[model samples]
Target: MSISLEQVHPLIGNKFQIETSNGIMHLELVEAEERPRRGVPESFRTPLLLIFAGSSRQPLAQDNYFIEHPSLGKQVWTIAPTLADHAKGQYQRPHEDGSTCLYYQVFFN
Candidate 1:
């Protein structure tokens, strides 16, 4: 199944179990950008983008870069997905309140 931001709303504020190739992955969406602040404060909080490659055993890591958009001005916090040693798996984003915002079941073969 494909995962999208709108598909996981039910799991937005809660922790849920994600079935992955490696095992059941526990994910929680912690939080999203609470409010927007004015002025350039050097940085701004961007929506969390979580990418999970089922076979990865180590901690997921990625670099967050920034770009300036004509409408949004400065766009920051880009989630770069770096796949681990394995292929084919599941991914999801769960919120602290037991809601999930995104989920995907991928098959690599």
Candidate 2:
């Protein structure tokens, strides 16, 4: 079965594995959920944000991968590099070592 955004929202702060050509890599759902659309009604269509975090060991700069979740099953997601707005400090994820990590954002209709 395919996985939906709603099925992933609740899994925030949890880890999920991705099947890659190299091997199995893992990532954590740092953020998820739909943001209130500017003009669209709350029930109509809200923007969804599926952000995943990974360490230097796992690189997601390649193509899409198949993500497998116990409840959500497996689904393919194309991840892209997301730049954290410097103006919006809240969107930034800083590490203890002063190195900011990379965050991949997935968009789906």
Candidate 3:
């Protein structure tokens, strides 16, 4: 079955696990954004951008990772650390609870 925004949208704020050499790292789904482009056919799915917040302040190196969710199962994708749209003034900012967290981003197109 194909994964769609509909299936992932509600998953925001939920935990997703990523397998790393350090073991299984947990991430929380933070944002899901649809980016519509001109000239793209409606038959093609709009590109979706997803961002996840990790509890660790340390950033992970970019690579293909096996990320899993209970309902979404396991899938491999290129994951990279991002500054979370730093222009928004959230770069390296502590979370609501004042805990520092790093952000990662993945794209689906």
Top model number, TM-score: 3
| Candidate models: Cα lDDT each | 0.34, 0.70, 0.82
- Model 3 misplaced regions, further than 4 Å: 86-89, 92-99
Residue-level lDDT tens digits of model 2 in 16-75: 888888888777787776665678765654567787776655557757889877877788
Error of 3 at 58 (Å): 4.4
Sorted on lDDT, best first, the list reads: 3, 2, 1
> Which candidate would rank higher by lDDT, 1 or 2?
2
Per-residue lDDT tens digits of candidate 1, residues 41-70? Answer: 545342223433222232223433342223
Q: Top model by lDDT, which number?
A: 3
- As a whole number from 0 to 100, the lDDT of residue 102 in candidate 1 is 37
lDDT of 3 at 10: 95
Q: All candidates' TM-scores?
A: 0.24, 0.69, 0.82
Candidate 2 segments exceeding 4 Å error: 1-6, 36-45, 85-100
Q: Write out the backbone clash pairs for model 3.
A: none
Q: Give the TM-score comparing model 2 with the true structure, all chains together.
A: 0.69
